[model samples]
Target: MRDTLRVQLWPLPTLGVALAVVAGVGLPRLDGRIRHDTPPWLRDYLFGGSADAARSVLAAIAGSMVTVTALTFSLTVVTLQLASSQFSPRLLRTFTADRYVQTTLAVFLATFTYALTVLRTVRTGEDGRTAFVPQVSVTVAFLLTLASLFALVLFLSHLAREIRIETMMSSVHTAAERTVRRLLTQRQDPADGEPAAGDPPAAPPEPPANVLPLTPGASGFLTSVDEAALMKATVEADALVIIDRLPGSSLIAGTPMGAAWPRTGEPFSPAARSLLTEAASEAVRTGPERTDLQDVAFGLRQLTDIAAKALSPGINDPTTAVHALSHSAALLCELARRDLGPRLLRDDDGQVRVILRRPDLQDLLDLAVSQPLRYGAAEPAVLARIAMLLRELAWCSTPDQYPTINAALARLRSTVDAQNFHATEHGRLTELTARVDEAMAGRWTPGRTR
Candidate 1:
């Protein structure tokens, strides 16, 4: 929760509030103390007008700030709504997390507060008393107003660019790439880290003598699992834990999360059970929706969902589906170069404590082509792109991964064959599938046109 609050853009406004308080209350007070030491030009520029004039300027800026904030925020919400209807609602997180939008809103709101704060400190110099003008502070407020106008322009331009489908694909693709990097770079074990991308998929560990049922405290999609924490708990309890749910899976309350097998073949003691439950619950985070942070399938699913939506009869947009496919194919190719297959988790003493369940090369390969093939069988362009995606994945995969890739290709052919299309379109799709199969079988040269 703490991490979410810090990273999520909503809480950023509170930071703006803090900044506004300082600028509103602190700056003017400081200026009052150092009024005589300020440069003459600065003082002259700020205090050339009467006290009412200065107060009027601050009041005008403060009022304008409110209008600007409202206009920008409304524009953002409207853009998001339009984008969601045209693209996908899953993209809401991407737009909301935009640093530029967040900063723009924060700065504008703070500018309003600063002007109001300084407005209170304004005083007329009509009396015999020396002028009490907050020359520097008022000047800074004017500068802030100008900066806010510039930010408004930036926000509008960014919103227009972000609403485009291609931009959303690129953002989602970059996020998936980051998730993959974290998966590779954040390995907890040196032994685990040393395996090559070509290593055989690790065999499933034998079932423990007795499986201790672990239940979840709440319900949501299991987005991430803390492998290191789970491994530590397993070591402390002297047991082996096997996860029942994958990262992209939804969960129900009190469901059997997984089973724990004791190393000594003893029953789970009360203390051990409590420790396991707490660690398991904390180690795995559940949220309303899936994120690419740890769940590899989540990212692939986003692309798949968008493609599926694009292929719907109401939309009938094959080009968007192909655009999404390009990223999905590239991500699969990137996955081909890394080892994210299921494997053993051994503790410091080399005692296997947990067996983690992660999507392997085959799972991704299936995801990369299945949805598009299913929804887009009749669209020659979509099928052609799927065939080409399969070819690229096949070309990049390890020698042993060919069978799985071949199986996926077979499924793509079956999908194309099942669709009722004009004879010419069917023949073209069939030809494309046959070429993809040949490429998978190593008969086609690398970089050959599909």
Candidate 2:
């Protein structure tokens, strides 16, 4: 939980403040020493440029930088708002996670701070005979002002491009694809191949008779589970542990994080039970919001949310919906080639220690396409794209996977059959359905996939 909290904390502002502090203290002092120690003539030639003029320049730049930084922040907030309204609020994570945006904000704020810090040191000595000018520091601030001006332009350009529908869809697609790959790679049984429909991995046997529930101290989404730590904890308690909630589950106070049962007939000791519970809690990490760390379904949900939002009555943008569906197809295609099984964690001796219910491939496929199709079935483009999506999944996946996609196609066909459509559109959908039906029947070239 501590590690999760650290990652969740926004670091850019802190980084900007640190950079400002370093520049503010270091540059001015260096410049002041050069002014006092350097030969007067050469200093006049270099460090001794007009103290009054440098001070005025630094002050102007400092004030202007403050205004520019404020403007940048305002525009960024507006962009975030527009993205949330137009796409899904879930997508705001992608925008916030953007390094370019964070760095841009950091640069502008840091530059402003640097200018203000050095600007205070530009004053001359009280005596008319002596003038103290940090010429080098003032020059650095002036250059920083120009760089910030350039950054302002870049941020505006980035803001414009980053909010486009294509960009949003692409970002979600990229994240989802990466997540699918990561989930598939972490599977324990490499040679088990993909799971056939109706033949899921056998469930671990029922819990031991004497069981104790372990409740978490905090409430949030379960971000990750340290399986190794959990297995060790189960061993120490001489018990079988079952995690009731999966990684993506939103935790509630007093809810069972999981339950443990003693391996032997003897019940667990209070001290042993307490230590076991503590270890279990430590193995699980929760946070305020869902992340993609061990939650692939969260990424799938993000795509569908955008598609569903686009198909809403207030915003009937079929093109965006179609675009989202297309990427959903891409992610599903990747998922098709991998096994989707509930993970059963075991100890070194091969005894089952933990059972976790992961989201199956079929569940993800439904999430990726269900709501979008329900909202978009009437639109010709969305209907066509969904049909194409089903065909691709049907063709690319294993024969056992065919049944699930075929059932989805059956659902689509039933809905299309019930809803009235224009003659041309109806004819187009009918043809697509025929092709998908053929694919589901295994007519496609074998060993070929996209």
Candidate 3:
């Protein structure tokens, strides 16, 4: 029951001060007036006594007002602080509702009620000896009510600001969810080798008997020699070649089954062999690194798109957007580390030079690889953070100056081909390539709704 009431009264803060004043000041005055000029027992029981008692009651009422007012002011300050910390200054600037008007109304009603109570206490008989001046209490109550109304207005205004923030955040969250779902749906799956529907049928296999024999020079005298002679030759030679004719062909039982080719050239130049070995090793190492880089790049692109959507003026509150951007950035860095490894060293210009075997890049590799997934898993939160960061970055210059992911991609594209290490390092080299092409064609506008 308590929880239900709490939920039902969730908007209490919006009119809390006004309600407080009505109950605290008006109710007491009204109760007292219900039994005017009562007997001593009735006065003590219902309306209390003379002006002295009314004064004490008014003091209590004033104290409550002061306490609530102080608390409201403190709450306002605290809420503002929290909002500032959570949202950008630009977002905070949008909240400009007036609080004073509501507070003024609440104070006016409360004070008027208090004044009425005091006036009732001071009423006197027609003799004018020591009559209670109900009018005096009414006047005091009127003034106090005005004061309380003003306070209430201020308090309600703050509450309104909070409500506005929540509304904006809710809108942003809905927009972000929609955007994410759309992007995820639009993502292109990796290409697999599915044959085209119209491809010609595979050719039929040849019969086993159709196989050909090796060249005469390639074949050995084993085909013409006796098994005993071939065995003697094999024992004498470093290697022996043998060949066999198909079953339908005429071949003596003494003929060898297969032929061998002796290695004649200098086996392998040491330098050449080493080069071949190293090339193979490098190929083996870089294949997966390239893949990781591509995946990370795709993730980053999605993140950027999410951030851009969150930052749209209509969307509100970029908390999730900002988080997404940070996450994507971390992921990109991780992929770079995994693929580039020790080769990801910083050059003199502070650019990351992917020298595949360089040792100096280890630290950067470690830092870059460790971040993205830890923070990116919560897509909504990540996107919010990204949006906030983008807003902050946007404020530094004109909107045109905003450093978008596309811009970075364009700059990189201008200097390198799609096959370049940096380009390939990001998992979606093809997507990035497409983006670059689209950007060059003026099709990659950032603020486009989708």
Candidate 4:
């Protein structure tokens, strides 16, 4: 629900419209009491026009505001299209969640609604009715029109900057960092159900003979899992639930997403099994697409998509790919310093009741580096960036995580060895590999090999 509201464009604007309606209805009543009681100097600030003139002004403001609102919507749609076509479609969320765009739309629509609402209260001396005009309401509407015009200019400038590639990548990087902080922790003790700081990892749990399959309610990417609710259900049924699907994995309706079994060495009763299945299905949430709520890899995947698309023959933007690699490397280094292991949810007794799968360092490394390594192999600059990336990761990685870094480093070395480069290019890459070795050995070597 939180992710849905964040990526939507309507909630804020609808709120603005609702507030405008309330203000429009109530402000005129206040104007009726104060229209004729204004101080001598204050009267100069209020609308001094006749009822007919007030109606004309209100109608003009209403018409212009609605027209501008349409224009703003068109520009927004164009921006979304450009982002989806040029960058990854996942970036659309960044734009849709922009407060500036939402605020601009809200201001415009609110101004239009207010003006139209106030226009109906205008009266002229006819049929023995006294002529009356909402002086303060008209002035407020005019002020809103001015504010809307200013917002229009600011929105245009903002849209211009947001469409740039650098701005888009930075936005993605910031979001990814937040996700990393929220979902991962600095190397923790394995005894506490976290990835070991320097200890040998625990072995995977064996499957029970009598396990009950838990199917999803619908088909989509698994966005989140309600661990607390799962823990409650697990404790009540005295069972252990293992969810194999990570966030961003595709789920099919009626397919086994996970399994549950009695925590004790016993089988579940038929009635208890049915109840467990229903609760498990409700605990896992799926959506039409992936969200960064709990998916650490979603950010990396978006950056990789940009790099991959840039390297495509149609685009052939190696410089962009290199920049994307730089960002990916920073995120990878951050991930390396943390524990990337499956999450274990324990109950009050401290026994693990739920196991949620998460990507390890090796999996994230492949996701972040493999595509660029494949597509950007021909570009020396890109290869150098990838080499630098591995070196950075090696420096931050713990000893237990060293094997994964070394494996990635070996692949980088193999890629460079296969390339028929000049002596200078080959030598530079060799120096980079040496630096990775030095980093892993807890040493820093400063100087060019040349």
Candidate 5:
């Protein structure tokens, strides 16, 4: 829900408009009282023009503010277009979630709303009423116009910086790092060959019979699951439920999501099967798009997309791809140090009640490395970064993660072998692969490689 609000452009600006309406209405009434208390010298600061003059001033401000607000919207749309075209479309969330852009829009719209609201209060002595001008209210609108101007300039400068490839990549890296830290826990070393504390025990062997096949209630991207509710249902039915889809996975209606079986190794009665199915439907949420709420691979996917887009023939920007790889390397190494796999939700009695399938190290490696390796094969720089990424992961990975790291290393090596590189380039890559070997063996040798 928070992610949804952050990625939207309306919430902040709507709030600003609401507040502006309140202020625009209430300030004019306050102006009637405050106008009498104004000191003679202070009168110079407040709007002292005639009612007609006040109308013209407010009218001009209102007209110009409307124009400025439209310009801001146009520029924002153009920026979104450029970002989507030049970079990956997934990056649109970053720009939309930006506080600066939202604040700027909020200020501009509030100014326009305030000006129009206050404009209606300007009165001339034509309808048997005394000439009246809310001096303080007019002054406030003028001040808002000035603020809108400054915000416009600052917003333009900010937009310029945001469109740069480096800025967008850094923003993605930071967000992905936050997701990694939040969702994953560091791997704990086992003592005396026992499973570490906080780690779920191995799942029981599959039951020979009485498994109930489950399907999704709706079709869309699986965004989140209500684990607590799912667990409650599992405990009530006395069954073990396994969810086959992760947060970023797509689901089709009436398609198998996973299975549930009675914990007693007996067939599920019709009532139990119906209860579990309803629970699964309500507990699992599908959305039009994926979020980082539970998906660890979403960030890596975005970074990889950026790299792949950079390596496209039309873009042909290998440097950006290499830069993106550097970001991916940091995230992959972080994941390597963390415990990852399917999540087991246990009941109050310590019985494993729910099984949620999640991406493990190998899955993440394939996500972070596969596409870049495919598209960036001919570029020596991109290849070197991929090898360096492997070496970094090797140094940080646990013993159990060695196989996955080694597999990725092999893929990198194969890609390099297929490339028609100069002798010096291939030699440098071969040496990097050797360094990766040393790192995997806990014998990281420090030396310069040419």
Candidate 6:
């Protein structure tokens, strides 16, 4: 009860006193004829030369005005302070430090002075036998002033609340805009033609026939070729022919003898023999590196799969998928760098050069494919074939030759798409092409002119 009263009394008293004062002074000033027809009894009570009564009346009015004014000001200050606590501390400080409080106080004092003057005039007018009190006008004016002050307080408070809300909304808007911009610009994957960072892993292909039997010689590295004629052609064109000798015979290192060219050839120079030996040794020693590459490729493939799944018709997890894709790409790049070295990794004129003469290119490609497959199943066969083509192009002598490889891969991809064979693989192969293109274009730049 006390608390409720405490809260109510301050505003109530302020209103009452302010009304009384404004009524007393303003009414008579606006109406000049208010001093006539004063009642005899009221005149005697107020001003029939009774100085004590006048002094007592004056003192009562002053005391009431002072008490109400002080209470109102204190309440206003306290309320503002509490409100400030609820809002931003900085705003509260500014509001409190403003001249609003002082202005309110000044208005209150003016009301008190006006009331005193009007009351004194009424008493004096009664003694002089003239009408002084215009009760209706005085009451109306007092009520209007009180109403205005209340309205003003309400208006200001409401305005402050709106400002705060707007500020909060604006901040939220800016943050959202910034996030969208980053996703659109900096984080997108130019290669895959999708937003960056949300790609699924590529699925693994079934293990190919491990034709370890083909290369029986301990020093001869054997890789099966579907086109024996093509393989022979390549060997002949490059002047690095591979000759197949009798299983039990120890052929000279530099002798050129194969199914295509049966007779044993003249021996090579010591340096050439040493180079072949080194190449054979490196190939044999690549077992651990191949395993590592396989692992990395498997991981990449999985990430690509996730990205594809996220982008599927019923799914909507693009952001998550994109993040995975980015991570996988970064890992793949690192692995490539470790195996192939920095020179081969550098993007140069829309082509990724993998100098096959260097021992690490095979390891890098193996790893790249392995990582992708670890996460999911392999892409379509056609796509896989296209990727193989691209990998082969990396062995080309010049960067300009990449376009020919790209065109061939594109045709292969189109054929696979048309056939609807291994749809997922086809899509993955397309994505791989895009990645190669992006890599050739440098970090973020896309659209390979070559």
Task: Please report the candidate that would top lDDT against the real structure.
Answer: 4
Quote the lDDT for 437 in model 1: 65
List the RMSD of every prediction in angstroms: 3.6, 4.1, 29.3, 3.0, 2.6, 29.8
| lDDT score of residue 341 within candidate 2 | 58
**lDDT per residue, candidate 2, 2-81, as tens digits?**
43433321577568868887988798788756655766666544433576787777778868877887787788778889
lDDT of 1 by residue, 1-450 (tens): 653553476677668878887887888789888876878766667645667878988899999999999998898888779767776777777877888888998988888988888888777756666556677778888999999999999988988898888998998899888888877533222354432235554576777646887766679988778888888888889888888677878878788878787888888898998999888878877888777667876677778778988999889888999999999999988887777666578888876788767887777877767778878877878888888888878766656677887788788888777888889888777777777667666566444343
Which model is ahead, 1 or 4, in terms of lDDT?
A: 4
Residue 170 of model 5 has an lDDT of 92
TM-score of 6: 0.23
What 10-residue stretch in candidate 6 is worst by lDDT?
285-294
What's the residue-level lDDT of 386 in candidate 4?
A: 87
Poorest lDDT segment (10 consecutive residues) of candidate 5: 192-201
> What is candidate 1's local distance difference test score?
0.79
Clashing pairs in 2: none
TM-score of each: 0.91, 0.87, 0.29, 0.94, 0.94, 0.23
Tens digit per residue, CA lDDT, model 3, 404-447: 43354343333333333443333333344454344433344354
Global CA lDDT computed for model 5: 0.86
User: Model 2, clash count?
Assistant: 0
The global C-alpha lDDT for each of the candidates, from Candidate 1 onward, is 0.79, 0.77, 0.36, 0.88, 0.86, 0.39
- How much is the lDDT of residue 416 in candidate 1? 76
lDDT of 6 at 343: 18
What's the CA error at residue 380 for candidate 3, in Å?
13
Q: Sort the predicted structures by lDDT, highest score first.
A: 4, 5, 1, 2, 6, 3
Q: After superposition, how far is residue 308 of candidate 6 from its true place, in Å?
A: 44
